[model samples]
Target chain A: MVNVAGPADKIEPSFLEVSTNKYKGILSWLLTVDHKRIGILYLFSMMTFFSVAVVFGFLIRLELIAPGRTIMGPQMYNQLFTLHGIIMIFLFIIPGLPAVFGNFFLPIMIGAKDVIFPRINLFSWYLFITGGLIAVISTMLPGGSADTGWTFYVPYSVRTTTNVIPALAAAFILGFSSILTGLNFVTTVHRMRAPGMTWFKMPLFVWGLYATAWVQILATPIIGITLALVIVERFLGVGIFDPALGGDPVLYQHLFWIYSHPAVYIMIIPAMGIVSEIIPVFARRTIFGYRFIAFSSLAIALFGSLVWAHHMFTAGMSDTAQFVFSFLTYAVSIPSAIKIFNWVSTMYKGSIQLDPPFLYVLSFIFQFSIGGFTGLMLGALSVNIHLQDTSFVVAHFHYVMFGGTGFGIFAAMHYWFPKMFGRMYNKKVATWAWAITTIGYNALYFPMFIMGYLGMPRRYYDYLPEFQPYHVASTIGSWILILGLIIMFTNLIVGMRRGKKAPANPWGGATLEWTTQSPPILENFHTIPTIEKGPYDYSQFEIPAAKEAQ
Target chain B: MFRSASNFSDNVDAVFLYIAGLSLIVLIGITVTMVYFVIRYSRKRNPVPKNIEGNLTLEILWTAIPFLLFMSMFYFGWVGYKDMRAIPADAIDIRVTARMWQWSFEYPNGVKTDTLYVPVSKAVKVDLKSMDVSHAFYVPAFRIKKDVYANKNNNLWFRSDKVGRYDIACAEYCGLNHSKMYSAVQVMEQKDFDAWFAEVSKKAGVQPTLVLQLKK
Candidate 1:
């Protein structure tokens, strides 16, 4: 059996210091097996890919500011949006929270030295970068990038003569990386918890990662094999998804969404876990319904997989298939609603701190509600007929994926910044950035709902004159959102470089990570802690002094 | 106050309003409660919190209430869908063929036109087909859309109560000019539609086939 904790050494270097000193220069990072270091590596790569995809999205929005082409032509516009979807969905959000925060915090939260397989953890990061590089490099190769949107609906995908093969190959490799990461996480959680920790005693975040790992393991291969089949059809002219041969195009849709829909849950469930973790800490109270929240994570994973056919409602399927999918879609919304109600109730009658992290959580709740409600509207068979393939679908997803998970990511950055770096970000500036980002985000996505209802389609390079105003407003909103992001990132950078030292328990968090040193030691805990209470037990501690000042 | 023209639009819009209204209430209820909780229970106001861990009654209420609410939404949606799927026996059948960047409608009398024409308040069943890749025959005013797959057979039916030109679009992304795949549904009075149908039949007979021109 492996040791739950290392030797009791009160004075030791942090993981950063030890890893850096143990090896010289870049080799220290490149060859390190520490989970925290791997997490940082994922953060840099994900952010870089995120920034590139954001520019692609910005240009797409800019080109839509007018009725006719404002910047790029039709072909270029198609390619940009396709690349945006490929990069953002594959390279960024799918692996985002789990790769970055989960890697860094999961083992630490569970009081383990590192992940069960630290070397595999490092190998996963390498696969991520290799896959990401191939995806980006394909953009410069002949035939440019794929223009089939990210769905790569067959017939069109097989028929289109772009550099789709490379993009598909990149996604296949990335799926392998994701599968390895998920397997590692599931094993680490199973075998690496501290002595006293039990199934019910685990933090909600760990449960979230556990559920997401199962999804990553189960659902990712469907997309990987499906994408590989498409590549095969493209090269060898097999009849898997080609209409010219004896294949069905709708079969490709069913297979694609089978994985992609659950992939959305994979993206958001961890974010929900982040919300569950942050709320009780900032609220200074025990979680209202811990078991409900934990079980709901599992419920979401199971139910999320069944609702994949909802994406195929407009794909010429039978009414029976449509009804079944629509009903299952509504069924999946209950767990999410249960989570939302529990989160709001947790804040009730507690000593709440209106901190930046909590503020992001608040925004997450508000935005996720809108996303959820709109999702219901889309799920409604009649409403879906009107809104399918329109800008409404586009807006609904951004609200959920970007507004919900993206905000969850920001909250984690703020909530755990001090714990990770031992430095405090400027709280006032973070607050301002949060405010601006919320305003800009709503401004950017809200009008798409209206125009989409008024009959504007999504993925259009040049729209009718009536849609010009909404597009113009959305374009301006993109500019504002980017401005806010710039300020937020810059503030984080400056704080990391020069800021006051953070306390070990800055926000008075009650998790095991809070019990450890800020920027935790080489082997997280000197002596393994025996958990006697749940993760949110606050009776033994008091709220720390306001750590607002830099 | 409404821009709807087809029979399905009212059903679609009513469901939208039903869900949207309830969602607004839930959204407002949650947001107000959240903001109020923040203000009413701040550390300054409530320094020490009472550790009320779990309430089975409240958890059950929330879970059961949303489940019930979602089922009602599902019922309304299903009712609207049943109406859409139940095609009338007297409905006129028209063949709709979608290509790379165009829509063509074939009348029962063998009259083919680039734009769709129909009599007001009369049900028209569209037999949707695609020549190459998949496209969707979408008309927002009618609140109807169905995918036009090449090797698949699909159909959509709608009856417009008002006589006006509504935009028809390909909702599914086809190649280079998917946005350019825009046509119009000209809903006319019965006599005018009959006359227009006769004129188009004569012209269609004179010309070979306009659809073949755009065919790849």
Candidate 2:
């Protein structure tokens, strides 16, 4: 076994230490099977797409600042929003936490050396990048890119003059990448846990990934097949969803959402896992209702699959069908509510640390509640009949996806930055970033609800004069949100160069990752840790005096 | 807020308020509890955390209470919707066909118009159909929306209580000119609607451009 008790500077070459590796230069990372390197690859690539898509998102807000074209024409506006949706939903958010943090930490948290299939893990990354590159190239194709929005609703998708086939092809390729990642994660979790790490004793993050992995495997294939069918319809001239071709368009929505709705859980569950991972460590207490939180993840995965029809409420369905889906939607809300309750109680009467990560968690609780509660209004059929296609729906989704899942990624980033990089960011600036983003996030989306309630449709290239005010406020919020993003990324980037070196277990976390060196050595541990305590049993946690001195 | 223009608008509003109010209460409660706990149990204040695993009773109570609350919401929502989906036998019928960027309303009396003309204080059922892609007929004042799908005869109805023009937006995203798909519902006096219809039929062979500006 590698030495574990070495001095700070004497620690062995970490997975990040490529200068001393025999592979040398670019080959080191590009050809590496190290899980940490793969995780870093996913992290860097995801951030790039996230940065590009957020700019596209800002352009959408800018165009909506006033009626009539602000910068570009309606055609460009349609394409921008469509690209933003595709890149953000598929390339960035859905695979976000599970792919990035889960790749890096899942094995470490469960006290394993690497994923069960390291080469396949690397292959998944290549496929992910290949899918991304194809999307990038699709825009440069013969007739420009797909402008059917991200949903790629048929007839429009089939008949659109723009180049939709490549975007569809890109999505088809990406689904394989998603499925393989899920397969790898499931096998790793199933087979690679340390001998003493019982299923119940694993970190909540691991449980979250486990549940999400099932969704990625089970639900992703449906979308893969559906996208493939759309491709076949396009090139082969076999009609599946186009009405004129003797196919039904509504059937396409059913197939898309069957996977896409459960895909929502794929995006958010791991975020919940991130919140679960952070709340206890920062609160300095055992996570409340560990079993409940773990089971709720599975419950969300289960109920999440059945409620896909909620999205089809106004998409022409029978009342009985609507009633069934609506009730199931309400049913899914229970598990989400239980998890929220557990998170709040986990902070109750505990030694709460007001770190940037915990601050983000507090905002997560507030913002995600707004997202979830609005989901209830949308779930109620009568209300959804009015709100389904309005800005209210847009606001609700952003509050959940961007506010909940996006902020969860930020929280996980800040919480684990030290451990991941072996360096620390400026806490004061990080705190400022969190506060500004929270305020800016609420300001950005809260007005959409008002406009939506008063009847403003989403995806409008030019809106009426009455909506100008809400649009103005939303545009201003986007500016503030971008400012926060700039500051946050800059601080983290700069800190990586000049920041203080981090110690193992910087947050006094009780997981096996905390037992290893910061930025962790290749093979992860000196020896596979035999766990005697659960990940969040913080009574066993002891903070280093240096952490208090900070 | 804009004026309510339909018979069941207030019913939908009441349900919205009930759910929105409860949501506000729970949202505030969640925030307050979270903030209070964080401050009350700050590391400086309580250096040693209470290593409490959990309380089962509290968990069960919250779970059950929220479940009941949502059930009540579901009931109220269904009640509000019953009036919307039930079309009266004596209701006036109009076929609404939406294309890429416009809505056309066709009357049973063989008159068709780009703008909807319905008599106030009478139940009007709209048989929604799409010529091409999917589009939702959304009139916020009346709180009515139903998807108009190609080759589908989905329908929705409303009874106007106010004689005024109301905005109708194609809520679903159709192609290029989706935003310009703005139409208005002209809820007129019964006599006014009859006069308009009669004039349209009388001038059926004449230049129709001037008559389109009747509301211009």
Query: What is the lDDT of every predicted structure here?
Result: 0.89, 0.87
TM-scores across all candidates?
0.97, 0.97
lDDT of model 2, residue A364: 84
lDDT tens per residue, model 2, B80-166: 777788999888888899998899997765578999988899888899988898888999999889888887788989999999999
Chain B TM-score, one value per candidate, order as shown: 0.92, 0.91
Q: For residues A352-380, could you state the per-residue lDDT of candidate 1 as single tens digits?
A: 88889999999999999999999999989
Model 1 lDDT on a 0 to 1 scale? 0.89
**Model 1 pairs whose backbones collide:** none
Q: Provide per-model DockQ scores.
A: 0.70, 0.68
What lDDT is reached at residue A415 by model 2? 87
lDDT of 2 by residue, A1-550 (tens): 1123345456677778843246976888898888888888999999999999999999999999999989999888888899999999989998789879999999998888889998888899998899899899989888888889999998788888898888988888888888888999999999999877899998889998999999999999899999989889888889798887878878898999999999899999999999999998888888999999999999999999999988877777888888888888999999999999999999887888788888888888888999999999998888888888889999999999999999999999998898899888899999999988988888899999999989898899998898899999999999999999999999999878888888776787777787788788888887776777777876655663336527
- Put down candidate 1 lDDT per residue, B1-216, tens digits, no spaces: 126999999989999999999999999999999999999999899988877798999999998998898999999998998888999988888899999999998877667789998899999899999999999999988999999998898998999999999999889998789989999999999989877776776776643222223323
- Where model 1 places Cα greater than 4 Å from the true spot, the runs are A1-11, A20-22, A545-550, B205-216
